[model samples]
Target: MAVASLIPPAPATGEPQSGCYMAATSDCGGRLSREHYISRGLIDGPELRVRGMPWQREEVARFSPDNLVARILCRRHNSAMSPLDAHAIRFFLSVEAGLKHAQRRSLSRKSRFYMTSGDGLELWAMKTLASLYSSGIEFMTPEHRFRDFEPPMERIVAELSSPNPCSIMTLSLPLMQDAHEEQIGRRAVSIGPIVDDETGELSGLLVRMHGIALVFNIDLPDKDALPETEIARPDMIDLIGMDRTSRIFLSRAKRRPEAWIVQIRLSHPRKDPPAGRSDRGCNRQPLRK
Candidate 1:
């Protein structure tokens, strides 16, 4: 199985040369500004960084609030999306609060968590997808030929902004046990394709931060065909908080013989032991059957 790189290279230093990614218009001209690749409100604390496929073997870099930015949107267009940013922040903060509450109580049973937003969450997802796609195009080089691998920006913008947007799924699980030192409270967005056993494919945009994951699937075919798991539906805002049983289920599901697989880490590591141990944050290897 061959895998393609969906992650974009770091931004280069230069004047804004690209058009607005969201509106896809050149009318904005020399007014483009640096836009945060991920919303700032969702991240907390100082050591903000991400690591995984494409980012592997790289030093655990630190990202100031302005680090993960691109000159894609004009000030006017960027300001227009503030409401969506607020919505996404609200959704993420709520999830974080719930996770903290669970940790404090050491809850061992299933509990319900709900968040309400009027299409803001969808818009936020759309904005993220557009930003990532635009950033990839701007930073493309001969060595990295990603033009054919990525989805069309026009098509993505159209579908995401439409009344009936593509399917967006959200799930909450325990903080990944093997999480990198700088990943706590940090947010990262990754894009790729998921190919199932039947050769069916779905373009996936994964946005994860603070123990919550949001997956947006472009042009998903049949929900029935997907593996029977608790994937939060596009219309459902209530989530099943992660617990022991669900954790076990997630661990097993990822190892299933037939599954929908993407080249990304979807499972969290087992909970860590008390601090001060050498292997405290080390990922617990999966048990062999």
Candidate 2:
């Protein structure tokens, strides 16, 4: 549980104004490199057109380099995490293919995909969360304390450099239906607070990329401590050898655009309690459809 303070104290007067979000020490030297919010290699093909939430608009548009690029990490730190980007790309590609296959089958059947490097994928999720958080630092004010609040940069850097699977939990699902398509892309990356029945605080980060949604929860509580009704569990197909699997299902109707349903099943079998749990933990917000 080596966690870093999400927000660092304001930088010193004479020091460099910005530093690498991952490393938290190396000054960009007034030249910060562009880091893709979503890996470029993952969306290079035509089928997967990139889309992002526009700053002022209520809709999502084709993602442009400027829209998704963030000048957060220095050259050295950015280069160090390249392998993670590649692993994440591969992991998502496998998932996309599995979803496509499930859709093509047009049956209420189950599908499972293996992740050879779960730690790598977890780090990728953490990196994306950190990147999104850092990109919006300028817009934050004292009143926006929730937005400014985050785990420490040093801890994040440590996780990105040497990820620990026990530190954070990650789950992924596909956007099967277009019912919320407009809102989905508009909310590409969002970080917020999740409060439990006892008013305990936890952080939630959601990242949607290429029709897939990845959700991360820090310091999740044990499942057995909460009632089953207060927890949301999706049907998951187990991956062979690995303890966890990314499960997907498609509706029987071939003509329906909402035929697909995807979910990320973690090995731990526990998740952060649902948002807004009353004293009895009777009412809970839906984690996903």
The number of clashing residue pairs in each candidate reads 1, 6
Model 2 per-residue lDDT tens digits across residues 123-166: 66677667766876332222344344555456666555442322
Q: Mark the regions of model 2 whose C-alpha exceeds 4 Å error after superposition.
A: 1-18, 23-31, 46-58, 105-116, 137-146, 162-202, 209-213, 225-289
Cα lDDT tens digits, model 1, 145-262, are 3333455567655554343444243232223333222333334433333323244333555555553455555554655533443232332222222232111111111132332211
- Of candidate 2, the 10-residue stretch with the lowest lDDT total is 250-259
Error of 1 at 89 (Å): 1.4
Poorest stretch of ten by lDDT in candidate 1: 245-254
Best by TM-score: 1
lDDT of 2 at 167: 31
